[model samples]
Target: MELKKKLFPFFSTVGILIVVLGLYAFKSDSATTERYVAQTRWENLKVLPQNISKDSLDYLMKNYALSLGVKCTHCHVPSKTDPTKLDFASDEKIEKEIARGMVKMTNDLNALYFQPHFPEPKPKQVHVVNCVMCHRGAVNPEKYLSQMGEMYKTYDPNRDNRKEMFLEQQKKQ
Candidate 1:
C-alpha cells in the first residue's frame, strides 16, 4: 500500500508530463503544417507575398476590382478543372501582366514618395497614389487630353496636335 501510494504520485506526474508533451508536439506540428499550407496556397505570385493570408488577399483583390471597375474575369482565366471557377495562377490573360506591372509601379511610387516619409506628418493630403488615383473607377481611364480639354475648355496644344485631334475626336465622352 505504501509503495502504491509512492508509485501513484510518480505515475501521475509522468502521465501529466506525457499529456503536456503530446499537446505541445501537436501544436508544433500543426503550426508547421499551417505554414507549409500557406506557402503552397498561393501560386505564381510575382508581386504579392506568397504567404499572405486569404482574408488579406481577398481584401486586396476586392480593392483592385473596385479601383479598376473590373470583375475577377478581367484578369483571371477560367480554371481548366472547373470552368466556372477562376484560375488565379494562370497567366492566360494579358490583363494580368498589365495589372502586375501597375502593382509594381504603385509599390515603387509609394516606396519612393510616400513610404519614406512615414510616421512623420505628410507633406500633402494624399500620402499614396493607388489604382484609384489613375483608374478612377474605370476599366480604361479617361484620356489625359480629354480631361485637360474639359478642364481648360480652350487650351489647344500645337505639339504634334495629337492632343487637339484627340480632344476634338468625340472628346472621349
Candidate 2:
C-alpha cells in the first residue's frame, strides 16, 4: 500500500512536469511563428512600394480584388475585357464612350471650375478607382452589410419620396 502511494505521487509529479514542458514548448513555438509571420509581412510591405509598376499594378489590383473576395467584374464590366469600358456594369458593350465621357467631364471641371480657382494642372492620368478608397478598414461581413444598408437607405431608388426622406435623415445628423 505504501509503495503504491509513493508511486502515485511520483507519477503525478512526472505527469505535471510533462504538462508544464508541453505548455512551455507550445508557447515558445507560437511566439516564434508570430515573429516569423510579422517579419514576412514587414518584408512584403518593404517591397510593395518598389514593386509598384504598370504591370505590377494590374497584377496587384487583381490580387487585391481576390483578397477582398471579389473580382474585377465587381467594379468593372465583365463583357468588356478592356479596362476602358463605357458602362462599369458587368454587361457593358461600349468602350471609349464611357471613358471619353468621364474624360470630358473631368476636363470641363478642370478648365472652367478648378483651374480658375485652384491653379492645379488638369489631371493627366486616368484615375483607376478601387474598393479600398471607400471600404478603407472595413474587412468584416457584418460591417459591410451595415455600411451597404446605410448607403442604400441614404440613396434609395424611390427618388421622389426618398430624396426628401434622405435629406431629412441627413439634416437630423
For candidate 1, write residues 55-84 as lDDT tens digits. 889998999999988999999999999999
**Which lDDT tens digits does candidate 2 get at residues 109-149?**
55665455543564543334433443443322345455555
Count: clashes, candidate 1? 0
Q: Candidate 1 has what TM-score?
A: 0.58
- lDDT of model 2 at residue 85? 53
How does model 2 score by TM-score? 0.23
Where's the lowest-lDDT run of ten residues in candidate 1? 158-167
* Alpha-carbon TM-score of each model against the true structure: 0.58, 0.23
Q: What is the C-alpha RMSD of each candidate to the true structure, in Å?
A: 9.2, 16.7
Runs in model 2 lying further than 4 Å from the true structure = 1-57, 63-67, 71-119, 126-129, 136-142, 145-153, 157-173
After TM-score superposition, the amount by which residue 60's alpha carbon in candidate 1 deviates from its true location, in angstroms, is 0.6
Which residue pairs collide, candidate 1? none
